[model samples]
Target: MNIDVPRILIAATQSGAGKTTIVSGLLAALRARGLKVCGYKVGPDYIDPGYHRLAGGEPVYNLDTWLTDEQTLLNLFARTSQGADVAVVEGVMGLYDGGAGGVSSSAQIARLLGLPVALVLDAKSMGESAAAVALGFRDYDRRTDLRGVILNRLGSDSHRELVSSALERIGIPVLGALHRDEMLAVRERQMGLLPAEENGDRETVSRMRAAVERGLDLEVLLEAARSAPRLSVPSLPAPARRAARLRVGVARDPAFSFYYPESLSALEERGAELVFFSPLRDSAVPEVDRLVFGGGFPEVFAGELAANLGMKASIRAAAASGVLILAECGGFMYLTKTLRTLEGSVFEMVGLIEAHSAMNARLQTVGYVEAEALKDTVLCPAGTVLQGHEFRFSTVEPEAPERFPWAFQITRKRTGATSLGGCAAPGLLASYLHLNLLGNPACADWFLGIASDASDV
Candidate 1:
């Protein structure tokens, strides 16, 4: 099957080159022109997609080759991009930065999907030397289609002219030039840009769209997107029709908002109705067959979550009644007996797992991990392997580490170091590892299968 979806990748020379701002602005600008736009982010990032959703007014999707295979990633891109005039993908870190051998890099994604690349070059310091940096990125990998460049953080008209002329001389088109504006800066915290849900304002996006409209060449970007070749991929079989026999409550407040749309969709496709409830604001958990706690900043809102004693008791009671529960990262921390904030303030959590989590001054781990299930669990059986990623600052300590039911043998991809992590029991699996169920559909099947059986009881 061949599909023609016009798309462009907005990548950067390195991190902090204003790719998020530019992409967000571009999405809003395109929508302002009455064009339906789809937004995507490369690699595993939950925060940027929040801004993308705000700007695009649609659910943003992720494209990661590490978490899923290339075919699966392409299928997701094609499926989500339907009915949109154009798709704008925000790249992660640098164009070539990824796991070992550039597995999930923006450059790899661009090449794999045949998407045109628009490099966002940080031009804060140098003038003509900016062209040299852009040239290096363009020439570094011939396979990557470097269509044009957007100059960010420019000083003056003269600066733009100098860099534009240099890039033009090198046969690279200058698609845009944004002057340095302090007002356009997005607020940041420990995990990078603060989630847009917490921003709670459209003024930032409005300012970004105005700047992009004043500086960028929208027509040229459209032309580059239209230049993308048709993507030929295998057609996916229609999903089997099945009635939703189980209800799954999902934690989805500002404090627990990290979830993959595809993962949730996978559950829905497998005959599970997802019910979203807030642990911070809701008084009680909804009656459901299973519960899911995704990753988020639970430590930041520990006081609020702890204050919701009713919700905590409801979750604890549900867990004790043999309700299947799955929690990852922030969700995992929320399931512990206690959570200590970075400032030494401690608060009680759901207390389903006999463990305590404490926020550290620095990141504890951040990388791709291959998880091999050590024992039978609700999601998977023993010896099942899944690909996922872990990024967190908090550390979990089991009250009785030696007696804890460790779920998986996690192996870091870069170092190959193995460690026993997570807590698993008959109807619970709580861990720091984040998995995209689209890549591991069997796990989703197993999860829903168990939920259906438990519902029957």
Candidate 2:
């Protein structure tokens, strides 16, 4: 909290309440005002944070209590917000929506960071009832500081007057009222919005920026942000773990881009050299002893990846050669035998594992998780405890029913559906779960142990 950045949490009453749309515009507006802006997402979402970075020029950091401990979350917020004028944290689903225990929601983060909240209420149809939602959220949590309210998708001047009068009757101040606009919404596919990296057309991105600028009132939002006080908190000490003198290959491309910058930095801090490569473009894995694949839109690039026969073969060879590998959601899909897109088009993938994944109508895995390594692999020592989240919309179709590999046992940390688990092949570990190793420092020791053994050179 020695950091001098003034921060505010952009939260809402529930999901689909237009929080992302409103927060993105606020970020773009602040950047336009010549202020150094940093954005943070309150949960483990890969897509929404991408748009935040596109507007603010900084990779969005995830703050979640279920996946990471309170201390690590605080330090991540403090350390990442260093040298920033202000920090804007966009909340997940709803203000209080979290996993099974409902303990790690956005409101928890607000109290933990001692930051004020500006609730974005969707007022397309509701009138005075919007005030009830705002008040309920404000009074529901005594510890949370509900500073003000922003009415999004408002109908007209008369509509705003009705909603404003109701909020005034309560104690929450009305900051701004935004009218609904179709053009202001960014396009989303199965997973969510495409990461800014895949959006090739700068004009389209700029047009989205312009839409955001014109929809929400920037001045009012910035004023609300400025009203928030600075936080004075302690920093988290670096995790105590062993180091390994090995190079780990990380996937970086249009297909696999949901990697947290901190995860890679943690590996380096623990003495592992990270070599980034693109599975979509590169014909082979880097000359490293291990591999780490994060999440992204592998479904969109299915055909291209299928055509990249050389890359697929090279990955298979690497696994066969006993290279330690860790693949997350999208990375996990890429290592399968094949991947089917939403349009029924299939692409060939590395056959290191026996499964074939296909896009489904519903997201298969989503939310925080606690995974224990069933076997000693690249990610952990045998029986090591691991914490992470799983997010995917695809299901695997194996050639043989019993051939499905389950090398790890996964338990959902919060309230969400259960997942199958991880797969293993002598030094390789892959799963749809995305884990931030800083919380559970043991992962560093586990990964290093595998990397050290594989780095026999």
Mind giving the per-residue lDDT tens digits that candidate 1 earns over 118-221? Answer: 99999999988999999999999999999989999999999999999999999999999999999989998777899998986998998999999999999999
Candidate 1 matches the true fold with a TM-score of: 0.97
For all predictions, the C-alpha RMSD in Å is: 1.7, 2.8
lDDT for model 1, please: 0.91
User: By lDDT, who's the top model here?
Assistant: 1
lDDT of 1 at 359: 96
By TM-score, who's the top model here? 1
What's the lDDT for residue 235 in model 2? 63
Off by over 4 Å in 2: 1-3, 199-232, 239-245, 401-405, 414-419, 450-457
Query: For model 2, what is the alpha-carbon lDDT of residue 399?
Result: 73
lDDT of 2 by residue, 1-457 (tens): 5645788898988887777777776777778778888999888777778778877877678888866888788788888888877899999888988877566788888888877788889998899999998888888877888878888888788899999999999878887777777666666777777566775554444655565576556666666666665666686655544443778788899888887777677878777888889888988888887788888888888888888888888887887787878888888888888888888887788878888888888867677777777766666666766777777788766677576667667777655445557686677778877887766566765677733453331
For candidate 2, the 10 contiguous residues with the lowest summed lDDT are 448-457
True-vs-predicted CA distance for residue 181, candidate 1, Å? 0.9
lDDT of candidate 1 at residue 184, scale 0 to 100 = 88
